[model samples]
Target: MKSILKVKNLTMNFGGLRALHNLNISINKKEIAALIGPNGAGKTTFFNCITGIYKPSNGDILISPKGNNEKINGLKPNIITKKGLARTFQNIRLFTSMTALENIMVGCHCVTKAGVIGAILNNKSTKAEERLIIEKSYFILKELGLEIYVNELVTSLPYGAQKRLEIARALATEPFLLLLDEPAAGLNPQETNELDELILKIREQNDISILLIEHDMKLVMSLSDNIHVVDYGKKIGEGTPKEIRNNPAVIKAYLGEEVV
Candidate 1:
């Protein structure tokens, strides 16, 4: 299987503290991978580094959207998004004042070709692009079962729906690889189950690879084809769910015991 994203010997430092230390991870095309560990284990920091929220102090962030590897470290966040990577936050980051539809439209900015001149002139091309963006955004809402909230303010939606909407907005960016930071956080059992289904649906229907940071053992074990365990900013284990479940280090660090 070909990898869509690869982080090689990645390291991040803040003053005297190192958040990540030579950590490496890879996600294959169409694969669902998980990064699991205790709090402050550097999972979210890894996401931040890859998504351009923070530049890595060392190592390469390589993206192969079409089998051609390109180093993406130090690029702007929007540039990375345009390079076919999109991510959702652990905390929901929606446009509170914008409707669900408008929020998604904001995501379309990276992919849209209409420049400032085109927008100012209101040319045929710009108008056509705007219309297409709206159409595509609405389609994504429906795909994520969010069409009913299309015109509703994001703040007005329930927690689970808002979580799903954050994902929907990421999808609006048309990513080949989606990074989800603790996607199942703050969800009830039913909502987590629904999220499990929704993630699989996104992978199957959109042909996109997924990498997530989640603490929900059930969801991680069921949804991930590969699981990587990290502790104190260092990798401790990497394997299929079964192998991770049985790994002694993983047991000692995150799982606490063998998963039944």
Candidate 2:
């Protein structure tokens, strides 16, 4: 079980305030790992650092896409995505004016080889690549059960479907590791359950590792192969779901009570 993502001595600072403190975490190949904590616990900050949205003040963010390790601390976000890491935001960030298919095609840009010249000249290779992008985008829509909304604007889709579309776009990037940020936010119980199933399907079908920051306890407990709990920018617990559910520190800091 090789780790696809590894963070060592991760720390983030905002002036005198420390958002994250010497945090260390990892997600293994094809595993669904959850980062759980109360709000403002630096979970999202950690994600931002790893994704290159904010360069960490101190630490190493390492990613091994296919068993080759590389430090990604200072890489740009798009560069990180091209290195096989893609993420969704806590709030949906779709191109509202774009159709669902087009939104996904936007993510495929990193993998496509068409440069400015190719696009202007409309060469055979560029045309073929454009067709492949369309074809692959359609396949992603179908795979996520979003074919019905393919031609619809993201603004017009239902809330749950909009969430799915965000994930579909991330998938279109062909990520080896997907970082989901509070994906079940604002969903009804039925929608949350649907998301749970969809996440499982993603793991099994795509064989992609997942590292998610979620506060939805049921979804996290049920979906995660391993759970890491953070409190006030420090790791409070890390273990299997069952172990985390019973850990006294996790209960006191975040869980508040026994999970069962």
What are the models' TM-scores? 0.96, 0.96
Per-residue lDDT over 49-145 for candidate 1, one digit per residue giving the tens place of the 0 to 100 score: 9989999999999999899999999999989999889999999999999999999999998888899899899999999999999999999999999
The local distance difference test score of each candidate is: 0.94, 0.93
Candidate 2 global lDDT: 0.93
Clashes per model (N, Cα, C within 3 A): 0, 0
For model 2, residues 1-260, the per-residue Cα lDDT tens digits are 99989999999999998999999998899999999998899999999999899999998999887788899998899999999999999999999999999999999989988999999999999999999999999999998899999899999999889999999999999999999999999999999998999999998888999999898899999999999999999999999999998888888886465643
Residue 237 lDDT, candidate 2, scale 0-100: 95
- Superposed model 1: Cα runs more than 4 Å off: 255-260
